[model samples]
Target: MLNAKSEIQKDTFEPASDNLSERSSILTEMFRKALFRNRVQLVGGILFAIGTPLIFRFGFDQLPINSSALSNTIVGSIFALTCGFFFFRRLIDYPGTEGIAYAIPIFAVTYGATVIVFLFLRLDYSRYLLGASYFLTVVWFTCISIGMVRLRTLRIGIVPGGSANALLSLPSVKWREIREVSEPTENLNAVVVDLDHSFPTEWERFITETAVSGTPVFDVKHLRETLTGRLEIEHLSENTLGSLNPDHMYLRGKQAIDRVLALLVIVLLAPFFAIIILAIQLDSPGPAIFRQKRMGYRGSIFTVYKFRTMRAEQVGSVDDRDRAITKAEDDRITRLGHFLRRTRIDELPQVLNILRGEMSWIGPRPEAVPLSMWYEKELPFYRYRHIVHPGISGWAQVMQGHVASTDEVLEKLHYDFYYIKNFSPWLDILIVLKTIRTILTGFGAK
Candidate 1:
């Protein structure tokens, strides 16, 4: 049997060794760098947006308009583009309208800001100029939106593997025309292959020739993880897990920053906290704060705190604790509890946990002890999440939402593993921003 352990190099899935191919082609290596494509597209889009003002200026200068109108036009465009950049930067990875979902909010905010600006400045421009500005802006964004959707819909080839089924089921990737491996073809964006799986001599030769000719090659496992944003547990082994060493220096720095920020948040939100406390007291008989034991860094257990969102229930044994999964329309949830849970204000109490060094501002969410124990027993490499301190909001929390069953929890752990494997401050910031959408939509709240 071909060894299923042959690993692909990080990021650049360049061939690990010469066994797969005789020699790598210069064009293939260049094409394998997909970041270059994204960068060029992004830079092109930004230049077009920045130049939009100039386009309007040229046209408006011919019309009977005051200089202030031109200045206001430039200012409004800058404001809109600035907001658009922030949203686009995050949404660019997603496919279809989902990639541009942030644009709707940015557009609304920009429209409001422009209305206020025009009102405040009292700048009266020709109706034609005003109408032209709005029209051009819409046209610019609409064309770019179409371009991005088409770019993401490129045909891709997949050499089937264990994760192929999962990738096939994801909606975001449904836009991609996925095909089985055949003779080398020039019309494909990228090819996903199982590096450890064997192929016929002719098939292997075709892949080598295609890869060397500037066709980007991707490992099936890595591509699936990138596309779905989840780490498949079945693909991981001891060597891979062992390679994820926690950077002590980085952790120390992150922890120090987390504590300071948590303290500041608590102080600022004290009034809101008091209001929530009062609401909880009036809504239920349980203590305002519910303390539960959760597994933390390096397998350490810590008491995590959250505002009580459910009725106080008696737990008589371990079996009862094991069955404590929250369900939709659960009778134990109070009216106020439902609101608090949906809004995630119930987690505000965890700021204290962060201050106490039991958690960070962002990391994997700490699973309750009973749930953690059950997961450890049922899931592979579940204990790996404890490598870092738990967090109030995490990759899993934002991406997968609240998991209620063993199957869902297994899916969540995939995201948790991805976060652990690729932890960075920028990623945490992105998650924090995305969490706002969740709070607003009350997505996945039980």
Candidate 2:
């Protein structure tokens, strides 16, 4: 039978093994992750947008401008602000008008959701001009999305000013030169780069996040020979750059924002929060509020609080990465605590952490001490994240969704840097609004 089959066909086959294919698969994953952030961005953008109307509806019920006019003005202002931020895409092309497309849709949804929710809860759309707000948001996003699709700004180039996100963050990508790059997506930024070089997925993620204007991109072949000094991976070709930033870390402004936000949260959520605390006491034999030593703002150790989500027996069962990072159906989670964790009510206890000067309203999340030290020893600027104070929600939480690997930490750090470099009260407010949406959607709670 073997001889007959061999004589009949005599064909030998081998599975595929191409370096470029390997690289492409890795990077494509990052790109997909990066693009997913837009979901959060979109939701956050919508909340701030729609929430504005709710505020105005409450505040300016008797105002000079009509609801439609007010919505248009705010949307116009948002478009105007974001439009100017573009570089190569904005300059020669329809930069200003393009981003309006995304802005408008998000704003529209936000206004609709916000006004509706407020009306449902508070019964006061009398002030909001919901129709006008929704119209403006729709119009704005339409314009912005059109511009983005045309410019493909998020699709190519060397990106900066945000987290060290995976290249996959961009919505779509197709290789102009398959021989040069393997991944499917890229950022469209001011930095003109030739993808005519190969890079590993981790390095590709770093370049998308940390490679800045002055850092010269080396041809893959030239990296070892031409580049000198402590060869920053940012200067290397996409191929040589490894899986992810082992050293990626960030610290945002901690003191002032934390104080204000924690106090405010405690005051606002006090009653509901008390019940959560009570539920924790009923569920297990531990403190209702679990306070554990964590690495914070620059790796400094501090106690971070939460309503104990796990049983006491499970407390030491799993490590932080395995145990603490919740999945969709983690059994370690308690019954009442399940609702709390899903709703992010478990985090409400952290407002006390903010009050205690351990974290900010927004920034990188605090790592457990052992995890922090372990990462620091292995990672390249892992401790740099602590340059500022830790935050409750920062660039990483909203942008990257959740952390799973050392590679994710590196990717997230790029985003943390972007937020830190451009830290502002406005950004904090934006994050807070986004946090609300995250809680509602439970986008990355797992």
Candidate 3:
């Protein structure tokens, strides 16, 4: 087993081709380094997108330039490209960010916002220039993404033992097992070890030396969580629970934003809401709105609202946990319910809950009363998820979908815990993107 494992490690981290002696010119080396730096990429891409247009329109006199139009174009293009660049950069730091797939939509949103602002202010702007800027922004970032993927390699050295071996199965990283303290570390981006396991004196010294030399040392368990986007909790402790506490300022700020946005949405979609209500009443022969008591923030039970999708006569007892769980293709779901549930349009009414401070736009999904009670009893530290206000859409909803079985819910709990552990705007943004995809694909819908 040892020999076979060694063989696999050898194949995984085959040395790069011996071409180090062939040094390029000084200028070329500097250019190569600068090309890979993210700051350089951001500034350079913006300049290329904006400068090329200015030079074409004014420098070459290709088109008659109006000063107001020129000024608006320059400011708008810079704003859009800069915002898009940073947004893309921050999102890629999180797990599950699809390479280059977000480029077009992100740029579209930034540029679209710029256009909205322009129209709102009734400012003159050249559509052609802005359009070209948008196109070039996507193209430049796409090229940068392709180049980085081809040029960069994440090679991690593993100190073989305990859970360290578990990370070897994860893809998107080159794993090299360090069998001896004498193993080379120059090529590795970082080193990982099972910190919970005792190490020999030499291996302990090696870990110290590696860190002293400026290489990052990571715990195998934490690294696994980072790579997999799940946090496994086997026991409860203050240190463990302490780390899961979200930023309170962001929490408060998020609540305010959620309510404001909810108000805006309710006002904007009022007409559409009426139409859905009428349709639901006609289809299901019951109240257009379904209200249920749900387990909410800090163990509070709150009334949650949704467009009625299930048949009225099929309503089950509130104490029945089984009925609270929506099974796959259940007969209780009305025809409109299928579409509403599939598209998550059923969740629209929950904006009122957000307005009421019982929920946010994103967080853990609150379970029905009985299911929540059952889970708290069955799952250890399950109530920890209530630290933040429940969300209309959540990390678990986007990642794992709707789960009914206790075993499946256990896994979903891990996802929820992971969200709480790494709670921030970036993760929320990623969830929002994933939620969009989920809606389109009808994933995790009952």
**Per-prediction backbone clash count:** 1, 49, 0
Candidates arranged by lDDT, highest first: 3, 1, 2
**Evaluated with TM-score, which candidate comes out highest?**
3
RMSD of each: 9.4, 15.8, 5.7
Q: How many pairs of residues collide in model 2?
A: 49
State every prediction's TM-score relative to the real structure: 0.73, 0.53, 0.87
| Whole-model lDDT values for every prediction | 0.67, 0.52, 0.83
lDDT, model 1: 0.67
- For model 2, where is the 10-residue window of minimal lDDT? 1-10
* lDDT winner between candidates 1 and 2: 1
Query: What is candidate 1's CA lDDT for residue 248?
Result: 73
Residue 388 shift from truth in candidate 3, angstroms: 0.5
Show where candidate 2 strays beyond 4 Å.
Answer: 1-191, 194-254, 317-328
Judged by whole-model lDDT over C-alpha atoms, candidate 2 comes out at: 0.52
Please list the residue runs of candidate 3 whose C-alpha ends up more than 4 Å from where it truly belongs after superposition. 1-36, 54-68, 113-124, 146-153
lDDT per residue for candidate 3 within 347-429, as digits (tens), equals 99999999999999999999999999999899888898999999989888987899999999899888999899888987898
Itemize residue pairs with steric clashes in candidate 1: 28-214
Instruction: In angstroms, give how far residue 130 of model 3 lies from its true place.
Output: 1.6
What does candidate 2 score on TM?
0.53
Measured on C-alpha atoms, candidate 3 has an lDDT of 0.83
Encode model 1's per-residue lDDT on 35-102: one tens digit a residue. 32445444544456545545555653564345776656655655665565455554444211143345
